[model samples]
Target: MILLFQQPELPKDQPATETQQYGFELSDFLSENIWYLLIFVLVTALVIFDYYRRKKEKNNGN
Candidate 1:
C-alpha cells in the first residue's frame, strides 16, 4: 500500500523552498478572487434559470 502511493524523496540537505512547498494554493486563490467567483456563479445560475423558464413556457404554449 505504501509503495502504491510513494512520492519522490526531496534532498534532506536542502529544505524545500516556499514555492516548492505550497504551489497554486486554491484557498488563497479563491479568497483573492471571491468576487469574480461569485459573479460567475450568479451569471451561470441566471442563464440556466432563464433557459428552463423559456422551455417551460414553450411547452405550456404547445
Candidate 2:
C-alpha cells in the first residue's frame, strides 16, 4: 500500500520554489452557504410537493 501513498518526485533540475510548492488554499463554497442552500432547496421541494398534491386532489375530486 506504500506505493499507493507514495509522493511523486519532482524533476531533478526544476526545484520547487516556496510559492510554487505551497499554493493558496481554497475556501469551501458549499460549506459557507450550506445552510442557506439547504433551506432554499427544502422550501422549493416542499412547494413543488404541495403543488403536485393539490393538483392531484383537484383532479381526483373532479
Candidate 3:
C-alpha cells in the first residue's frame, strides 16, 4: 500500500540522557600502591624481553 511506504513522523519528546558510571581509575590505584605497581611493571617487562630473546636465539639455531 502507499500508506505503508510513507515515512513515519519524528516523535515530539526529547531523547533520553545516558549516565556513564564504570571505568578504570589507574592514577588513584597506582598512587595507593606505587611500589607494588613498579615491581609488577618491571617483572612484566623482564618476562616479555626474555621471551623475545629466547625466541630469537631459537630461530637462529644457536
Candidate 4:
C-alpha cells in the first residue's frame, strides 16, 4: 500500500520541483479537509434524505 505522505521521485524526463516531487494520496486530502468536507457531505445527505422523507409523507397524506 502507498503511504499518504510519501514523497514520490521526480519524473525521469522532467526537472525536479518542490510540489511535483511530493505526491499526495486520498487519505492526505481527507485528513486536511475532513472537517469541512465531512460536514458538508453529512449535511447534504441529511437534506436529501429529509426531502425524500417529507415527499413520501406528503404523498401518504401524513
lDDT by residue for model 2 over 1-62, one digit each (tens)? 87998779965788777656776323455777789899999999999999999999999999
The 0-to-1 C-alpha lDDT of every candidate, in the order given, reads 0.91, 0.83, 0.82, 0.86
**TM-score for each model:** 0.67, 0.55, 0.53, 0.54
Name the TM-score of candidate 4. 0.54
lDDT for residue 57 in candidate 2, whole number 0-100: 100
The residue ranges of model 4 lying beyond 4 angstroms of the native Cα positions read: 1-14, 17-25
Q: How well does candidate 1 match the true structure in TM-score terms?
A: 0.67
Alpha carbon deviation, residue 31, candidate 2 (Å): 1.1
Which scores greater on TM-score, model 2 or model 4? 2
lDDT of 3 at 51: 100
lDDT of model number 2? 0.83
- Residues 1-62 of candidate 4: C-alpha lDDT, one tens digit per residue: 57986778855686867546777667778899999998999999999999999999999995
Total clashes for model 1: 0
Best-matching candidate per lDDT: 1
lDDT of 1 by residue, 1-62 (tens): 88978878865688877766988677888999999999999999999999999999999999
